[model samples]
Target chain A: MGLAKRIIPCLDVDDGRVVKGVKFVNIRDAGNPIEIAQRYDEQGADELTFLDITASSDKRETMIHVVEEVAGKVFIPLTVGGGIRKVADIRKMLNAGADKVAINTAAVANPEFVKEAAEKFGSQCIVVAIDAKRVNAPSKALRWEIFTHGGRKETGIDAVQWAAKMVNYGAGELLVTSMDRDGTKSGFDNELNRSISDLVTVPVIASGGVGNLEHLVDGIKEGHCDAVLAASIFHFGEFTVGQAKKHMAARGIEMRID
Target chain B: MNTIAVIDYGMGNLHSVAKAIEHAPGNCKVIVTHAKNEILAADRVVLPGVGAMRDCIGEIKRLELDYIIQEVSKSKPFLGVCVGMQALMEYSAENNGVDCLNILPGHVELFDANMTNAQNERLKIPHMGWNKVTQNSSHPLWQGIPQDSRFYFVHSYYVRTNDNNHEAASTDYGVKFTSAVAHENIFAVQFHPEKSQHLGLKLYDNFIHWDGNR
Candidate 1:
């Protein structure tokens, strides 16, 4: 068998609790991060991503604690994203038992941070999260631009060029999130995913806008992503990770199915 | 209680490795250290490396862990992981070709940039994700582990031994590459057993009870 396509269930963690919102709005509490993480692991999630959406710095310690507890019990690869601004932040997360750290706004603010973090910690642990919004309509030439501050501020950077630049700056993986389709329960922007995936040599994780098992399949088959990350679909118990894997495997996608 | 010294040269997921060992079924004191004395005193030793081969080897030499690792590998139940596995080879094509510990007879090479699968699709580098590893030969470490089990892997470079007898397991990632290697008391793998979930913990448990024999 070859390298199986990964199915990652993302948990939007806020103050140590798991939360999910529609297009980054109307937040709702899911459950405890540790319990949710264990449940996902039991369901055969290939990997788990924890996006720390906690706004207050004082509450950030909760995220670290959550990572530590889950990491102690969960055996799969764990990735921590959000609020990672400095190398110290990356260190704390890694030391807290996170296998990888994803950087978004910080990388946009200072591209050098990616290089420095990758150098300090191996590139294998550094992931560049890109939040992209479509600049052109469905009929026009495909174009997407990077947005920061939870997709409110525009960086005026092309998503495709930014992805390649991050890889050059030593990003081991790219987490591409579609702003337009995120939480809409529609699907992933396959064009945007393919655009960034084809340009970079590192693995690209397609995130945001996963509504069904078919979307997971499209992320790999059409979007060309190495892995698919969904927050609501798996978090809300709409579909189990095992079901997603079986569906993807049946659709001719090589998945890690026991 | 046995002590498994996870040799720390300032690289790799030392926390995860130590934690996994502690969580394994076997009762052992897992310490993440670079002190030669502690490593020598331990019943088992683990060499874990991440990042570029040059950096991994550089830190091993800078910290003077090379001799310690060599000494422990001779008699102790030694396990190397990822770049740790590559570092056991004589040479590596990574970081402009660097010398390794040469504990095992092999050369580490990068997966071709243009490497494609049977479907003619180009595979990503690093080969990041869960891939099934086919056990090539029977060994103590393979005790509870199934014949073909999936393990978590995240690396661009792979090991190729000069002697086929050193290969313990293989995985197909476009090209069939050696995923695990065993030479006497030493066993090394390109995949991360600590991050590989239940099956991975089983491997660590097996390593703990291994007697460093055939």
Candidate 2:
């Protein structure tokens, strides 16, 4: 069988609780991180990503505790992100039972940190998360620009170029989230996903704007993303992971049926 | 007490591998260790590696786990997972060609970019997620695991054995490639059983009960 496309459920955790919002605003508590993670795992999620949206230094220990609890119960790959600054941060999360750690602001603050972390703790465990917004510039050819601080500020780095550079810096995977479509649930930005996915040899996980199973399919079929990550759809029970898998399989996409 | 020592060369997620073994339906003590004595003394040994082959080989040599692995593989039931499986091969094309343990007669190669499926769609690198693995030959590890069962894989490079006889199972990623191999006391897989859910745990259960004779 060919490689299967993955459906990942993301938990936008804040202050030790899973939260969901509209465009990263108007936050509302969803449930306990551990309970939500266990539910997703039982629902046949291919992978789980927990992003501590708050990223406050004081809440770091709580995040680690959440990771340990979720990992102890869920027997799948768990990716922990948000406020991951240094190699020690990555080490702490991994030791807390996280399979991989995703970094955004820290990597932009110091690109060498990405290279160092990859060298210290294998590129396979290092994921570079990029939050991009479509720039409506008439002069420049670059369509999307990278954003940091939970997609609040723009970094002026071209999204496609930054993705390739991260691969060169030893990023095993790229989690590209479209800020413009995140929380809106219109659909994945297929054009942006295709551009980034085509430039890098590594796997690109298309994140954000997954309104339904069709959006998830587009992420793979058109966007060329290896996997699709969604927060609201799976979080709010708008769609089940099984439904997504069944739809993809019906469309001739190879998925684990058993 | 049946003990399984998971070799830790300061690479990959050894804790997850240890926990998966502990959770597997058996009363076994799973230890993540780098000590040679503990590994040699354990009833079973698991070598789990991740990331680049160059760093993996370097750590294996520096920590002298290479010798320990060779010794342990000869006597006890030895299991290799992911890059641990890749390390058993003679060499890998990763990092511009890095030599491996040479425990098995094979070499690791990168996924060809131009490779496509019957639909002419190019497959992504680091073949991630669940895909069915065709059982090439029946072995003890396949005791409960069904034929053509799905397993979780995450890697850019895959094993290409010189001898097809060692292939226990295969998977199609653009082209058919070896996914699992067995040679006497040694059993290795390019996929991660720990991340694979129930069927993966079944593989671990079978491994724990295996006698290493086949």
lDDT of 2 by residue, B54-154 (tens): 98999999999888888888888999999999999999999999989989999999988777777776666667778888989889998888888888888
lDDT of 2 at A219: 93
Q: Which residue pairs clash in candidate 2?
A: none
Error of 2 at B181 (Å): 0.9
Across A174-242, the per-residue lDDT of candidate 2 in tens digits comes to: 999999999888999999999999878788999988888888889988999889999888777787788
Q: In TM-score terms, which candidate is top? A: 1
* Cα RMSD to the true fold for all candidates: 1.1, 1.7
Off by over 4 Å in 2: A138-142
DockQ score for model 2: 0.71
True contacts kept of each: 0.76, 0.75
TM-scores of all models?
A: 0.98, 0.96
